[model samples]
Target: MKTTITVNGEARALDLDTRVTLLDALREHLGLKGSKKGCDHGQCGACTVLVNGVRINACLSLAVMHDGDEVTTIEGIGTEAALHPLQQAFLTQDAFQCGYCTPGQICSAVGMLQEAAQNWPSQATEDLTAAIALTDAEIRERMSGNICRCSAYPQILAAIRDVAGEPA
Candidate 1:
């Protein structure tokens, strides 16, 4: 299958097998290794990437399904020269220990923030009609899909709170 996906703000044209996953395409073909294949299943959020501003597990998605879509990997969110606020916060807070899940955590955080800004309610939300309060519970519920094996939840929460304008 010939697919063209706009990755990291650049159009990448590739002829890939129909079974090629978006994760494989990004990591193997495009050389974007930031998105890791943790569980190789949707159970782990390590393959999370932003597709059309929404986060999904890249390992669970086919590359052909994302043709003509704008995909943002960790590389797209920010660079070493100018880190994204979440990236910088993660650093300042030491949110990652093994660092295997940091990329997905950051990407998921970006999409999760956008979702919260749009008044999307999570299971922890007490009031569906009101603006999100972004309480600790709310943050935890919203980010439940991403798991850090190193158990850096506290620091991760601090990083997210810092980016969300909440006191750590």
Candidate 2:
């Protein structure tokens, strides 16, 4: 099947197998290998990417299904000269240890920040009607999906909070 999707602000057209996972499409087809294949399962969140402005497990989605959609991988977020705030925060906070999951974590944090801006509620939000504060608990809850096997939760939370304009 022929699939065309905008990736990293560029249009990428490729002939792909119908069952090709989005992660594979990005890494293999488009040669955008920042999104890693950790467990090859959605549970790990190592292949998380922003599709249509929402964070999703790229490993769980098919490339053909996202035709014409906008996708942002870690490479799309920022460059080395001008790092995204979250990326910079991650560096300053030393949020990553092994660094295998940093890309996913940064991508997830990008989408998570958008979610928070829209007042999206997470499991930690007690009052659904109230604005969700970027509390430590809230950050943890929202970031639960992106697991860091290095157990860098404290630094990760600090980086996220820093980008969120909260006291780190």
- CA shift at 36, candidate 1, in angstroms? 0.5
Residue ranges of candidate 2 with Cα displaced over 4 Å: none
Candidate 1: C-alpha RMSD after superposition: 0.8
Q: TM-score for every candidate vs. truth?
A: 0.98, 0.98
| Residue 11 error, candidate 1, Å | 0.5
lDDT at 83, model 1: 95
Give the whole-model CA lDDT for all candidates, comma-separated. Answer: 0.95, 0.93
lDDT of 1 by residue, 9-49 (tens): 99999999999999999999999999999999898799999
The 10-residue segment with the lowest total lDDT in model 2: 159-168
Pairs of colliding residues, candidate 2: none
Tens-digit lDDT track of model 2 for 1-168:
999999998998899989899999999988999999999889988899999999999999999999999999999998999999999999999999999999999999999999999999999999999988888998999998888999999999999998899653
For residue 35, model 1's alpha carbon misses the true position, in angstroms, by 0.2
